[model samples]
Target chain A: MSIEVNNIHRIKPIASYIVVKVLEETKTTSRGILLPNSKESPQKGEIISVGPGKKSESGQLKEIDLKQGQVVVFGEYAGTLIAQDESSKYLLIKEEDVYGTYE
Target chain B: MSIEVNNIHRIKPIASYIVVKVLEETKTTSRGILLPNSKESPQKGEIISVGPGKKSESGQLKEIDLKQGQVVVFGEYAGTLIAQDESSKYLLIKEEDVYGTYE
Candidate 1:
């Protein structure tokens, strides 16, 4: 608790929220094509902590939602950039911001 | 338009929906991980086309749900696999399947 309380990189996620670290950066082409070949394989991020789940329109809890330690893909256009531990981070994107979770 | 109208990879997406082509594959390591050293740069996908946005519970349309030609990242656990033009593809992931769109 003390460790995370001090480390910005380490955060205590609220219910219905997720903690993810950027793992890769992708390179895009002039026509908005991401060259299959980037400078290298893009970085990968890990889901550290997770919020419980989102409420559905009918007011019931949504499904499993996001989980801790799951590798996720996100819409680059979504999310707001924030600085944590003096490093750039993003947060609170809608569940839609999450794409795939690799196994 | 004509090209997409014919080619399966070349799809005509509806407004508010998107058509994406997978460009890379991500490989995760043990302990719930993505090696980052995938066989190659993970395949990239292009938003070939899109569909009309989903309506909100209030009946208004949602934000730019998804667009054509936007390279996207998705959730490993989300989306149903479908075959278009007899090739493997994914679809209608509730707009939540999209992650980042590189610039």
Candidate 2:
């Protein structure tokens, strides 16, 4: 279990959510949550990876269908969660803390 | 000492920067820093505020000039800083963590 690749890849996690890492058990969401900063993260998880968006300014890249493992609900005050690992359940929210994406 | 206006003013905080409230005394330079989450917040403060645009998809609103009190550098992981105030400085980042705007 080793994965940490980077080629200066870190838009800093605002490329737009689609980050899943639960593997199983799912049910206890407040929806995408990430709001905290004083020096680098304050909490993390809840918005399981998401892509298909962000780059819109005419640079044209606007396309969100919420796929990459789906299961969202963000906006407890959304955006700002980083826990790339710890089996704590990978997280890094944005895309407006998702707030709407569920089955 | 009371200020908190809103018309559902909570895209969570991703409508694009421009939010000042320092009083007087600047120069810490960490740029626009924000990140962390698990519940609601993890830390907060540092991104005085800035905005000029962000609303594309042909709805046309792409302009990002970073004003309203410019002094940025967002990207300590880019975006997520909420403090509102308490002489605490007022934080709420997510303009791509601003990472470039200083003078």
Candidate 3:
């Protein structure tokens, strides 16, 4: 199945790649001070769609351990920016790039 | 079996990784002028040992396509430098990092 983000782009990840909806953090600090965007922090995103896993050397399609809607963390530089619109941005990353899932 | 380089380091690759013996290019030009080492060129190496292949999602070990003594090419920056001695240097690289084999 394909994931429709912002009801605009229908994306279907392939081969162990996953589509993530970047979860933007609150731009303001606890003291109500606006903070500039930082690239050093680990990126947090919600898995929109997971691919059918990568193929093994024997040509078998292995299943990925992740699922859609899981909030996952990844490196700041990981994944490729796929789509960016007014409201949200999307990234396409390999399953291995995902560090782990969080609450 | 482990591969020995310079009769000093015995390396055995693990899980889709391969030990490569870097083949140093000729330092002299056509006119016998010594050229400085360049990192822009693709590195050439001979496969010293191949890993048993990465395990699939089912935990089955797939077989690597390469074999020992085969000359392969890879990106200049690919792989990790595992060992270096007086006569030869060694690198540990994944099978996927190998571009292809040549005579």
Candidate 4:
């Protein structure tokens, strides 16, 4: 693992959960207007740590398809938010909460 | 397919989407207090129509694991809401938006 991952391992996700470092909220709209604390559902973030995949009916561990370092979009209120500090915040979401990943 | 499914076919989902019929909102809380228009996410609904599947990176169709008639929990604002009529309302959400299914 890399140093960045090591840093993120402080709060490892369990089960089918993943830790996501929230991106800086866009303060300005496309029209150049300021908007604070947008309530949009689909928010983007970078994946930190992924947990072991959920068990199947037959007790098989199906691995998650997502990878760490990938930027993904999910429902804003989908997961439990953890504020590491005053400036940094992370979200612990299930793998299924992720809608799509961006390149 | 059953008659119920045929009726739901009028609004067949495409791609990785699924049609969910919103359950009646609980008018009262456990304390018998009225709460209307709750803003919480992860609401429960019954699955109606499901899409064929989503195209993978290799352009293969990946079928959704959910089945019809299953009630699912999802972020309230995760999907586009469509009012079928005065009383019936549905949501069009991607397969990944579903958090879990209840028996």
Instruction: For residues B27-62, write the lDDT of model 2, one tens digit per residue.
Output: 221232222323332222234445556777566776
What are the RMSD figures for all models against the true structure? 16.6, 15.9, 13.2, 12.4
| TM-score of chain A, cand. 4 | 0.76
Q: Write the per-residue lDDT of candidate 3 for residues B1-103, one digit (tens) a residue.
A: 0112353234445457777889987757679987666645568999878866766766667889999999998877776554444566666677888888989
Query: Tens digit of lDDT per residue, candidate 4, span B1-103?
Result: 0112223455545457787888866757889987665556467889877767765434456999988899988876677543233445556688888889978
- Model 1 alpha-carbon drift over 4 Å, by segment: A1-6, A9-11, A26-44, A85-90, B1-103
iRMS of each prediction in angstroms? 12.2, 14.1, 16.7, 13.8
Q: Second chain of candidate 2: TM-score?
A: 0.27
1 against 2, candidate with superior TM-score: 1
User: What lDDT tens digits, residue by residue, belong to model 1 across residues A1-103?
Assistant: 1233236455655535665666544343223443333111222346766665555577655433456777655555555433344444545454445544444
DockQ per candidate: 0.04, 0.05, 0.03, 0.04
Q: Provide fnat values for all models in the order shown.
A: 0.00, 0.09, 0.03, 0.00
Location of the lowest summed lDDT over 10 successive residues in candidate 2 chain A: A1-10
Model 1 docking category: incorrect
Candidate 4 residue-wise lDDT at A53: 70
Best by TM-score: 4
Model 4, residue A52: what's the lDDT? 74
